[model samples]
Target: MNNPFPYSEDNKRYYTWSHYLKTKYKNKVFKVALNANFTCPNRDGTCGVGGCTFCSSYGSGDTIEDKFEPLDVQYESNLKIMQHKWPKGNAIAYFQAYTNTYGSVKQVSEMLKPFLFKDEIVAISLATRADCLSDEMIEYLDFVSRKKDIWIELGLQTTNDKIAKSLNRGHDYQCFLETVERLSKTNLKICVHLMNSLPGESKEDMIQNAYKVGQLPIHAIKIHMLYILKDTVLGKSYLQHPFPMLDKDDYIDVVVSQLEVLPKHIIIQRLTGDGMRGEQIGSEWMFKKTIVLNDIDKAMVARNTWQGKVLETK
Candidate 1:
């Protein structure tokens, strides 16, 4: 069958990160997840406490193999492991742990300066919150982006402010919009993270989130199903009184619908998340990452739909 999507090298119906990197850089590219030893405002008593209800004790950095090591050591160790697969590939230094931009301008600069000059490092990705970004921090990041590709990853798990408050997210949807507006004037690329199946949200609510953000000035997005892990508030609560969650087939359906609404030019960084084994308490279906992604592909093909299908009609 012919692939209707114009941006894909393979038969994928949506724009993929691999296609974006291969077309731009002409080589394999991967992210080396690093723990920058930063803490969030909510976790450190600046706003609230205990972090997000779903965040684990590692602040969602459980996948970082050498998280406890120094930043340089952590980057070198992980990059070497990834290069064993793609021997000549370049890397994006991903600050995957807590709020990477929660510190002062000097602290953030010190953390990123070493990696900026490395030849093998092609870009830097920092996962941060909207309320944490100060004017000075934004200026510094914008300045550094002139030297190297800078990606500021903001987590807006859901658009519903009520749901956000229930999870103790610290900030609301308005904060995210303001932050994106500020970053839009800079050279930095913005990637927003959205999670489906958050507590108290419906399938329509999830699709609406895609519709709204797809109209923004975002360069990319990462969507994943929420997985409850042990040692977290949500996990402990689920153990006592479980809430309804989406099954595999329903999750694929929602993901395909999300893609249909999203613009084709925006890169789909990730469609599914890798839940750390032995720690995840519910949503066990996310363990089969490849199967979930393949099923989403099949669903899109079966419906004869490509990305931006709805937008084209409008």
Candidate 2:
């Protein structure tokens, strides 16, 4: 079968966003958001205590905090960014805020209808949770998929039950599996969010978790380094325990190893994440983010490794 990932050229992985967009559309496409203003279960007390251990109210908003304009404004501005950069390209209105599918089906459809009318928006990507993936929601997703490309992003931060509970993600591996099964039965594409070097998680655990994720029916993977942002539950825990974030070299080694085991066919949406400068609570290495990504690429090249090498052995 042909590789479905937009960026799979020459059977090698492409890592840049622009490259991925070009490859996906055979031209260019931007990810704009309609911002449905959905709330997360974690914050609503339906899940557990506070939100995910590493997630703050801003939802790791640092690089684009200033870009948090109104829904229409956000979409228009993002579209402008894409048009200015890739003049011939199109855009996708991605409902990227927390739990986009958490609202009623009618509400979601009504909110998203405006974007669908635009010629520039060829698809929609909804960032949501597994537990929130209801039958009605899947129906809506299938409905949207028929009109345009539909991508649903699920955060399965780690498969480790211990870490899931510790992070208060409020869902289990079973929940994630069920959600993927449901979506796979339909036509919606799936992307996953994972974090590495989280407190109380080990290198072995991270590798094992990635292997488990590889087994799931996912089309893309996004990996982010753990950050203890201030004013969050995880930040408070860090203050109490003072655990170390991954060192630059160690983090790169782990990321490279993970990539080696991750399916090369899967699109890599992100390699590193940015935390708010004032909110970042650990790791001097994080001060220079590119230093981390540069080291990861160099190490991968030197080792001649990609995401699924080690997993194949197992």
Candidate 3:
């Protein structure tokens, strides 16, 4: 009763990405969220128009470096900043904006090639939509897996069809599952992105989405809390109607419930996401990342629960 959860190696509760990387590579690992000037298929009209309801003008890459500079220049410059902060740590070249696979196989190859041989960079992360990945993209990614570490992040904010439709995500649950199956043929690690406090999602719906992802073949997951930003579709809508949102404590309870169902082997890539200062309009409490994270740790300890403590999904 006096001890914290017993799921992860560090014994905090969940299987964190930091612990996984540090133990596997024997050093600290930081992901450099980079931009490649890519665009989403939805905004381009391949799937839909106007992009996702909540997507920022930066295409969800607000924190990434300026895209005007060449990819190598950005990587090298950012590498220096990271190196100074943690002298012994390594970095992951993360292509974070838009649908990274929207480009041709050759274009995608060029974007990733610069980091393949970089000694200081240990891995590469590519974020994209499930509907945007073509067969050629998979072929090229598979070829790279022989030598370079690759992690593919797919955004599937919510499994609920109505919520996805409302968000204009432009992809269904089946599409996401199919893409994961195809990508599994390669050695690249897979991570699914889920969001809490969506427009119409219930507490149980969030729990169900977590269980669904855990049953899949993914190696990691990123749980983002929905925060309405200014001047976007979601922001405007929030101003008009102001849908119900999760308070800090309610969000903590929902997240802990998810952790109970996810398999211990799966890595928790993110617990909450941040919005650009002066841009986000809702869920203001999320700005304090440390408080949200600390509360999660405390909640798990008080409840005597841990990641995958239930060990059953479906």
Per-candidate clashes come to: 0, 10, 0
The superposed Cα distance between candidate 1 and the true structure at residue 116, in angstroms, equals: 0.6
* Segments in model 1 whose C-alpha atoms lie over 4 Å from true places: none
lDDT of model 1, residue 22: 90
How does each model score on lDDT? Answer: 0.92, 0.76, 0.87
The local distance difference test score of model 2 is 0.76
Per-residue CA lDDT of model 1 for 25-81, tens digit only, reads: 889999999999898888888889999999987888999988999999999999999
TM-score, per-candidate, Cα-based: 0.98, 0.89, 0.96
**What RMSD does each model have against the real structure?**
0.8, 3.5, 1.6
For candidate 2, what is the TM-score?
A: 0.89
Q: lDDT of model 3 at residue 71?
A: 83
Runs in model 3 lying further than 4 Å from the true structure: 1-9, 312-314
Pairs of colliding residues, candidate 3: none
lDDT of 2 by residue, 88-148 (tens): 7788777776788887898888877777778777778888889998999898879878878
* Per-residue lDDT over 127-221 for candidate 3, one digit per residue giving the tens place of the 0 to 100 score: 99899888888888988977678899999998887889999999899999999999988888999999998987899999999999999989999
